[model samples]
Target: MSENEEGTPERTDVRKEEEDSPRDRTRLSDICADVKISEVMSEETTVVRESESIEDIIELMTRTPYHSFPVLNENDELLGVIGQDNILELLFFERSHRHHHTHLMAIKALSEDASTLMVHHPVTISPDSTLCDAADLMIKHHIDRLYVIREKKLAGVVSRADIIKKIHGLRRQ
Candidate 1:
């Protein structure tokens, strides 16, 4: 459809065929395997303290674009993740939406601090891990993002959007 640098007409049909070939798929997978998590993750991540009150966390949710935040202890160790689902319990006072009333939801509703309210043992990946590893973990856990942990501390964060963007960029090149 267009002329290349050599002043010859480029065969777009053949190029399209090549893109859909198994070799190209293998190349893409190789790129994913080679790319590290630290290269694609956001280092300047927003986090919350475990001791922070529910009011403070609510305020933070209102101010930030993030739907979830990694909860940290005084020593900066990652404790858990506090997401919108955890905060939604506060909206209902006496009644729960589930068919069977859950005692855990009621406890979450009564929780005062981030530590008690947060979801424990959040899915995490190491910064040293590959982008493919991150993708696999996210798919297995059905999560949109993963907290990058190092030495039990929050190192960074990688999101599904980040991986998609990286793949798109590579394709363009």
Candidate 2:
């Protein structure tokens, strides 16, 4: 593993394969079904606090390569998720596209904390869930990452890159 441009650890040894190859697809499917989310998840997840200011979130985003962060309350319970897209939209509110853009824009202008900026009810998966289940949820929700929730708390996180690396590992083996 090597650090990427952003200083995030990256698996440089993972080889890319043809996504449409029938044999590879079959093998990937089998592997996904067998592997648990906990096996490939990022155990020490960087998270944001609901009370954190937008400046704090921006600072974190600049220092870390993560595109999103799980927002937690004082009790360490999952509240929601705040992503780069959320910040971007707020920053460029003039080009808003959502039906409730005005409403959101007003809220953003008044609130500087994560609790108001986060997307509630984010898609999540259990630590015991199979990689297959995580993958399915990601595809269904068009998301790049899923927060692993266990006992109503954040357990870890599973990203699309993690699953890809797992598949690559199996292919090489």
Poorly placed runs, candidate 1 (over 4 Å): 1-23, 98-100
Local accuracy of candidate 2 as per-residue lDDT tens digits, 71-163: 999887899999998888887776666664777577875688999988898888889999899889888879898888899989988999998
Q: Which candidate's TM-score is highest?
A: 1
Ten contiguous residues with the weakest lDDT in model 1:
92-101
Pairs that clash in candidate 1: none
Model 2: lowest-lDDT 10 consecutive positions: 13-22
lDDT of 2: 0.85
- TM-score for candidate 1, please give it: 0.81
